[model samples]
Target chain A: MANSASGESIIRRFITIISAFDDKHTSMSVAELGRRTGLPVTTTYRLVDELLLERLLERDPKGNIQLGTRMWELASRGSKTLGLREAALPFMEDVQSVVQHSTTLGVLDSDEVLYIERLGSTSTIVDITKIAGRLPVHATSSGMVLLAHSPSAYQDMILSRPLTKYTETTLTDPAALRRHLAEIRQRGFAAMPGVIVPESSGIAVPVYGSDSTVVAALSVVVPRDEENTAARVPVLMTAARGISRALGWRGKLKGTLRQSH
Target chain B: MANSASGESIIRRFITIISAFDDKHTSMSVAELGRRTGLPVTTTYRLVDELLLERLLERDPKGNIQLGTRMWELASRGSKTLGLREAALPFMEDVQSVVQHSTTLGVLDSDEVLYIERLGSTSTIVDITKIAGRLPVHATSSGMVLLAHSPSAYQDMILSRPLTKYTETTLTDPAALRRHLAEIRQRGFAAMPGVIVPESSGIAVPVYGSDSTVVAALSVVVPRDEENTAARVPVLMTAARGISRALGWRGKLKGTLRQSH
Candidate 1:
């Protein structure tokens, strides 16, 4: 809770340091870390020293600091993300084996779709989804499925924002997107062709929790020209249901499914 | 890095709060967190407030706090664990599909086998492996494979310690375990039947990184009575090589394999 002279808390500074590491930028020197985090040299070194001492960060053999295995362990040991990923993996594997493409399980996090687990070959399609990677809510089938099941207020809040148009098919208009969300809800799935990429299509279905609330989006990426919506949707829906069941979700009664604005 | 009156840094306290949650206790009230963490009530409340402010922890509708999605994202985005898991998952899926058992990817962390990714039917076997769960280095097939590939000094350090005897079949003797490690290295896999759990057996092979270093242990847990080491070891070795190649490992040249300890 202690605030630095610049009015930023130690936690915020810590977050800045941790956020500097991504898939491509996994390790760097303390000086580079300070520059990336915009923290003072002394402050960065001090914080890095603390984090290293706590085993939250580690120095590679090359002496560049990287996120430590301990940090991952601490975050994952009690994480709901890990729980959901574990429950969905077998079903995802089933889907991947059948579909022969990338299958991903994503959840709504910080207003974006954060992919938690993915399987299948990377060479199959132009799939950009990665574990812990985020994509725009409007440009992804997984995002649309999650948004379609979200509360009307949250949906409105998301749609009111300026949406990024990633491709020719990406719907950026709020009204158009709302209509798409309605269709997605009514159809019980979202199939977007070339919304994020030009050569691939994403089909996603809602995976529910014990309370019958949509907890994640189970999705698959396939070649855009080979977009077998009707065929792929069934496989996705089946796998989603299995994952939902694994999460303690009983099948919804015939009429209990709710619609959003 | 400042230590409190108790001589513990805030980072240590942060770890304590996160460590309080596990597979069973994913959420808890601040009061209960204080009790579990053994921190003073005021300190717990203060730290909890800070964590919640940063979205490192989240409050549920029932007022119970859980590890936030941000924590998972921050921990995962720059993690080598995620990178390793991603690389090994597809191959592990292939192994799991064929083996029809629990496939796990483990790495040496804190002198134990920390399972980072696992797949398969939990109902099929008495598998103690959970994502983010730890097992003693000597009691697990994955751990033994990792230990066998590690430097002799590190192996000596581990074998010199008092190891827990989890089952009657668990080899705790330094000299005997050393011989077994040698055999595992030569045989190219470890098939430990009833080493940790009497109802289950573990089969493991080493996964190599780009530099040809033993990066992880890929394993499967099956029923002890159905231990098919002859058929399973080859499958594991094949998949481990696939995972290693994905991690940028060039093919191992003939006669390059070295024994440790």
Candidate 2:
């Protein structure tokens, strides 16, 4: 209803302002924010003022603006992700304890994998996943597991797009990717070695929700040379099952039963 | 810039809409949302439409609207809370393992204790702390530790307010609380027995940031009957130091050093 002269809604401009900040640029001066968001200086100031009034944005002692704790609280208090994260954390810890590597819980969002919860390790693995960070759905084991369980039409939609070959082993050909997705569904997990990063391998299994539908992927990142799938997959599978049960998943429907080897 | 007929800005209305949903009411019908937010039907619908366009809100299969994953991602991606949470989690896990009870990391926000990261245990200690949930500053050990470390002006402002006595042990007298704050500052920890929930006790230690400023509180909840502060405080203090170190905190300032008992 509140469209600017550019025909963009206020919400769009708000999103733009918030999106200007990332992990690298957690705080910035108003002038820098205006430049980064590409909004008119006056518009940026006005929106920032309103946001500050509501404590949706705050200024540090150095007068640089950053996202407010209120924003995080409001977003988290009612978020479905919170419930999923709470349900998965304990089991993810168990997996992390055993794997002694980075363990992450990710969901398919916006055609990418959004890591919601990640327990990092002291290991020297070259894992790049960060909480709230995104990765291509075709280049990681978690993404592959999520994509394999998604509806076929959605898979087709993703496969139709040009995929980036991040590493030598990354599958970019749609036919090959489709075959791989089918195999992942059949095997109930995905183990991709050096697909995104040359030094790390990701092993992931699907986590089901109350409806027995795949809701997330619980995964571990280990050294590429140590792709011990037999030892790792069972740990992930067991933890994923625990998470699924915590989320009220009553087990798979009879006809859709899948086995993990 | 976009103020409604009642003179509330679009951002305020947006906050109202989002705040209507919470852990207990994660999703709701549009009409119910309008009623809950107390915004006009038309305004609610329009804002909901815009928010849906940005994927800041999503509808469940039952046509009920809830906070979107994008909202959580946006709030988390650049949030200071995320970094603090990440730094605290590994140590929080260790504390949880030993305490075998709920461990929480909270920051003082809007004059209350807002728990950012909590590692829940299987113990039946009656912990009321939830991630993103808030409790009054006077009754929570996390809140007291935070308040104790705060600037004198801020502490005076809080002390001037009419404090709620949640339980018989909750200190509502400004003079008593001020004295208690001094004790907490001197002792380097705050342990309140059944101050909020009658059955649970909270032992909290201040977690410092790089500047040696207390940025958050690391605490554990235990049964009131077993108020083992001697054993619990050291574990919390150890974990808090680890978290502080992870946050780049070196140690206390030379002249302002305090001892933990």
Candidate with the greatest DockQ versus the true structure: 2
Q: What tens digits encode model 2's per-residue C-alpha lDDT throughout B10-92?
A: 88898988898889999999999999888899888888988998999999888889999999999999899999999999999
TM-score of each: 0.95, 0.97
Best prediction by lDDT? 2
Give, for candidate 1 chain A, the lowest lDDT window spanning 10 residues: A252-261
Kindly provide the TM-score of model 2 when superposed on the true structure, using C-alpha atoms.
0.97
| Model 1: per-residue Cα lDDT over B217-237, one tens digit each | 999898888834667877888
Off by over 4 Å in 2: A253-258, B1-3, B253-258
lDDT of 2: 0.90
Residue pairs in candidate 2 whose N, alpha carbon or C atoms collide under 3 angstroms: none
Candidate 2 C-alpha lDDT tens digits along A150-237: 9999999999999999999999999999999999988888989999999889999999999888999999999988835558988898
